[model samples]
Target: MTPRWTATGLSQDLPKGVVMAGHWQGHDLAVWRSATGRLQAWNDRCPHRGMRLSHGFVRGETLACIYHGWVYGAEGGCKHIPAHPALTPPATITVTAFACVEQDGVIWVAPADMAGSPPAVSGVQPLRSVSLTCDLAAVLAVEPALLGQDILRGTVQIDGQGHDVCLLVQNNPAGLTLHALCGVRANKVAASHWVENLRRRAEMKVAA
Candidate 1:
């Protein structure tokens, strides 16, 4: 089952004034950060002509659909329509918005009505994200020490020492994406190589 909050990506990956595609419980999301660093996640579809809002551009605090230049504000309400500059967009012309927040260097999204805060993941810093061709089961088969469905916690060997690692699992249509983090004092370079090796082993297992 999906949790109340789903880890989308790392905060550092989606910097200010940039938009990226994300997924949460099978919902495609257009996650973006404003010029001032405010985070937001909305339905990836544009209300105008079904164009993907993820293909849109971020201007200041608003997102503009690349298809027809339809501008949506922070509240997901249509602020301007290039075709009708003199007319105000109706409040009904709004994109679906989700509850989005940044915690522990990770970006999380859930239904707007979701309650409580995201799961706490302390003592680790953002590492790297890796997309594997295999599923979660293959990952566990390769490293059974890793546990949890949503957030996988385990100790991985890096540079001849055990280092705690956290893998925020995201089940994407193609496969799975692991938004990883490692202990603050761990060798990040070695940890990253370890992640790559794990991906290789898991994927090879699936192929076998």
Candidate 2:
């Protein structure tokens, strides 16, 4: 809530021309990437009829609401109204836009106005993202310092050895969501299962 950048997801999770539902600091967001690979985040509600924009589709550089077909450009301004082909929507008819950027394969957003870049992680290749039915504190308690902050570094035991792992935590309504990045030579299957195990442990901690 202090206007700091927070991780929404891993970049690879959102391919070109895709819109994903994201949450930051209690605000619901519609995070989309244009066909040209430009990333943009906006309030999930449409200016027209208050439609959920995350249910909308992406066409070229614009996001179109499924209900009214109101097309919004990267700047979040309405570019076209299907009901009125010749009329250009006023500037006031725009979705609330947010600051978005990609760093270290993570898509981060600033719900409020902010200038700095998102936290960066080095030497970690994004493996996957998983949601846990527990709070951030629960996950942090499981791994402590290794997975406690914005950027986490630790090791997961695989085949009797340790593999380096990095985790980016996102607070969501469902609880804590984690974007995992593993070392180059790490076994993905092992890393994935390790994440599931962590989730179970964290959730158990919450239940206990």
Top candidate on TM-score is 1
**lDDT of each residue in 1-208, candidate 2, tens digit only:** 4677888888999999999999888889999999999999999999999989999999999999999899999899999999999997899998999999998889999954787778778887988999988977787788764755676788767656788888887888878688899988888888888889889999999899
In the order shown, what is each candidate's alpha-carbon RMSD?
1.0, 1.6
TM accuracy, model 1: 0.97
List residue ranges in candidate 1 displaced over 4 A: 1-3
- What overall lDDT goes with each candidate model? 0.94, 0.87
Among these predicted structures, which one has the highest lDDT? 1
**lDDT at 97, model 1:** 98
List the pairs of residues colliding in candidate 2: none
Query: Cα lDDT for residue 101, model 2?
Result: 93
